[model samples]
Target: MTNEFATLSDFRALLAGAALADADMFAAASEHNMQLTKPPGALGQLEDLALWYRSWRGGDNAEIAAPQVIVFAGNHGVAARGVSAFPAEVTAQMVMNFQHGGAAINQIARVNGATLDVVALDLDQPTQDFTQGPAMSENEFVAALQAGWQAVDATADLLVVGEMGIANTTSAAALACALLGGAASDWTGRGTGVDDAGLSVKTQVVAEGVALHGGQGDGLETLRRLGGRELAAMAGAMVRARCLRIPVILDGFICCAAALCLAKTQEGALDHAVAGHQSAEGGHARLLEALGKAPLLHLGLRLGEASGAALAIGVLKGAMACHASMATFAQAGVSDS
Candidate 1:
């Protein structure tokens, strides 16, 4: 795929100039929702969700017919530090499982009628251990972002980006701590089912990485220093989705950390996206709170393959169906008392 951005500056420019949702369409959708046979606000958050979707889609009859899920896989050198319960090679093996349709995200995507694409980024060349130094150089970081930007399908009306990387949750914690100005312990969590001792190690690693790389006040730089290739790609995909006016259902902690990079870089950068669900990861709730995003579901999920977001697609589709297909009081021959 062609590179849309040659430098982080270019990407930042795109984020700064990204278009906002269509107000006219949003107003129309809100009015139509009130006219439905059901009482106003009866659908609760679904009502707002449908309207928010319509605003980006720019139509009174917007429907989620073409949703796309992209799962990015990358190896992190930090896994060698015993931050996770799984080996780094599991990232590549899980990518294969996704390709073979054997993963939970595969089944969830299929059920949501969404096409899935898996992008494996240099699994053989794991990033540098971030505690020692930056995870990726600027060129490598830009390349990862372009990988995510090119992975998006223009035909897709909605987008969901996920990741598969061992020790990525550690990366996410460090990234979040660097961006959100919190202690490492507040952002760190037991990723991949790490035991208590492992969690302590993970927390210390996060602290060290953030101490070495944090407080730069540059989101992109922090992302390059602390985030994985897959995390960068997820950030890239979300930016591309914004440019295309495609609404996104953000996944869990890792996905949110990637998004936080964009959000911190530009105001309203995540205006086209919504939190799909809150993960069981200890830091996920804090991340969501920082983003000012209330998750649509909270089933204690921490599976990172975009499983939660893909499943939330059904919830969005249900909202769209009720908004676009349900009859108004006049059409249903019901009195509007």
Candidate 2:
């Protein structure tokens, strides 16, 4: 969480305080896995998943006791540029839908045993269109990010961060290009099913935004300059979850962009984050690659708001169950054939 600092230097201190994962449990889990009845590395990804939990928790045993998906909702001023098929108002409507238990994220969260939370930012402001000046004042961005960090569940065994906004893809793409030296055309995709012309405009907007603010500073600085409220909040949640030793599963492209920002501020922030899925959006795979993460699932999932992470939580649960339940070779009384 953000510390009580009113200045940029002090804010940097708060961001720099994200803690690292301890490996004592990881060492023990590795030894236990080798002693399990199965062949070495038989469980494949499940073993990796179990070890991940143990490592981050700094314990030999870990379970996803309470899973959560916190969705940060905001509106994007760049949507005025006609980037998305849906208007910015849809962001609020979807927030209502999510609260009403009607959106895809709600259903997935219920089925996967995750509590859903929504942090609605100022849709009315939408941050001054980045194409003009800074999207928002540093004060507004800092406060919104702090709100997100506070929204994270400190007791949660697994944290999944998602976002809701119109034309946020443009912001995410621009941030990606600026921080990773990518081209807008390569990172921008059809968000909310834009037409060919809309795609061109979106691409141009991202390209222009990146050119305007690219290479200005580190990841967090780039995020502050080119990101939307939802994106900034997601980064805050990620950094805080890592600080609390809670594992995080990042949603799609927008989520990954925020994760990249968190990673920049805290080296190995990705150590506490797992890519829930590879988004169908353009540049998500590239972003994941840049973060050195292999997603757990892929279903062409493009709906933001943590839908992908909600669905993937079950997989993590199943993997953790296997690690916690399987009997060792001696317990099973099985020969090492």
lDDT of 2 by residue, 1-337 (tens): 4355565556567667766666667888888877777888887898898888878876545557699899999888889999999998999998899889998898899989889898899977887788776776788888777877789888788999899999999999988888888578999999789999999999999888887888777887788788888898887777677778888888999999988886776676678878899989999999999999999999998988898888989989987877777788889998877
Evaluate model 1: give its lDDT.
0.93
Root mean square deviation (Cα) for candidate 2: 1.6
Q: What would the per-residue lDDT of candidate 1 be over residues 235-326, giving only the tens digit for each residue?
A: 99999999999999999999999999988889899999999999999889988999999999999898999999989999999999888999
Model 2 misses residue 208 by how many Å? 1.4
Show the colliding residue pairs in model 2: none
Supply every candidate's count of residue pairs whose N, Cα or C atoms clash at under 3 angstroms: 0, 0
TM of each candidate vs. truth: 0.98, 0.96
